[model samples]
Target: MNPNTTVALPQRGPAEHDRREQIIKAANEHFRHYGYSKTSVAELGKSIGVSSAYIYKFFESKQAIGEAVCAQYLGHIDATLFAIADNGQSATSRLRNVFKSLMKKGLELFFEERKLHDIAAVAAANRWCAATNHRAALYGIIERIIVEGREAGEFERKTPLDEVCMAILSAMTPFSHPLMLEQKTPEELEERVVAITNLVLRSLAC
Candidate 1:
């Protein structure tokens, strides 16, 4: 064999990719219905008609599967905020949509899919740092909106970017925290979210 020879490694075929997706989908349903911790990798494989070893070929462990499920949950949200950030709307307008979408998603997940919500909560509790990173990725979208506002002369840089990001996340705690906001009526929640959005905009005024 010549040392200088370039080997052409095989790319993953569509069939294998499809199988992997099937596994993740099955894992999510198991987590959403039976709870994440309660679903073993073997159980997941059994449900999919595959062996646990086959499951391992896709995901190393139950924890990995849980993380994948959480990713699936966040994907829709990230796409929503991604669109908001990319739009030509004013920063204030984008911020309103951002918060509105987040609160709506929270209500749907917390009420309609309580077991899935529990899986996310348990994952965060067990892996605090990774969970923080997941939240940070979303917060970074807000930070990008703030930067745009500053550049467009609609907002003042009253504080550092990181501080501003944290402040926005802090202000949105009620909307993001399902337990606290769950008690409020729909009308009450809307009123609170609208009021806070206005307040946040005022603070960012130039």
Candidate 2:
């Protein structure tokens, strides 16, 4: 090795792939413990016995790490909703269960991991592409259920599909909204969510 020579770093590959997952996993744990704002790249690197620069080779910034964690979490939630949509249950049953499942998981995510909630909220407000696209896919699930209900004579088709999807989401806000969730009592929240869900369903009935 020449005194002034530096070797070029290897480009990212499968070897780097596992380390990247490790960083994301560690970041998730750190965010849960320390919150997103307080969780530093330096701390994450230290936790994994790497330098902050090395972590950057995997993720560009602290926010990037936070986004990765949020992505993973949201992906699981989406998968849950997607699975519910695919079940053999009636459209009404699927819709009802979607609300039930989302309410249960949303509360857990909001209360149990406040930091993760904040990260997700910011990601949406900032118009992160993944957030928008994932949300669109989620909306498609709801719309499909609505369309199914209409075809089966279980629901009215007066409203446009997009409008119905929007309305459904608005109705779900109480249970699914991440921010401002702490303002309501758990008992009241549950009651309100159930009432609103029923109201939305009834409005669509044939």
Candidate 3:
């Protein structure tokens, strides 16, 4: 190297990004094992080999970390629903698939990861940005399906699109909302979800 030639500085961006991800991953595992409400930021830091202050550098508070973890879980469901919406199936079929997938995924979180589900419930109860965004994404998916059905001449266009979408969401609330999922067994939800979805589909038919 020539004397006085400037050496490229090591990039902190990727390392900082990796550190932030590591914090989220560790917090997720901690929350899953111990539950989000019970786990503190100090516990999370200890689990991840970082100080509480350092973790705070990546997240504003324990609730912020919980939001990140909740977002990760909800994001998976959103992606799955989006894929179903875009599939080449008839709009009716895609709409039905979307309802079924939402119920299936909600039940999975409620039953399989009971503890982790608390974070989601909290997010919803507080109208946290993660939960709000997830709901919007779901609504968008439903709207897309509805638009497709109308364009295909399979569904009535008489109903205002917003009204139809809201009606569908309200009908599916018991099966799709995290807190509401607690009211019934998986079997009960399955039976009712099918009935509700079919009812909505019939109402939409041209």
Which prediction has the highest TM-score against the true structure? 3
TM per candidate? 0.81, 0.84, 0.90
- Candidate 2: tens digits of C-alpha lDDT, residues 100-157: 8887877787878777888777766775544555566567778879988888899988
Ranking by lDDT: 3, 2, 1
**Model 3, range 47-66, lDDT digits (tens) per residue?**
77889988777677787788
Best by lDDT: 3
User: Per-residue alpha-carbon lDDT of model 1 for 1-206, expressed as tens digits?
Assistant: 22112222122334357767878899888887888778888888888799988877766667766776776676666677789888999998998898888788877877889888776566556643334555665687788899999999988987888777788888876776556556887678889899998999888898
Displacement of residue 57 (Cα, Å) in model 2 is: 2.1
* Total backbone collisions, model 3: 0
Q: After superposition, how far is residue 74 of candidate 3 from its true place, in Å?
A: 0.3
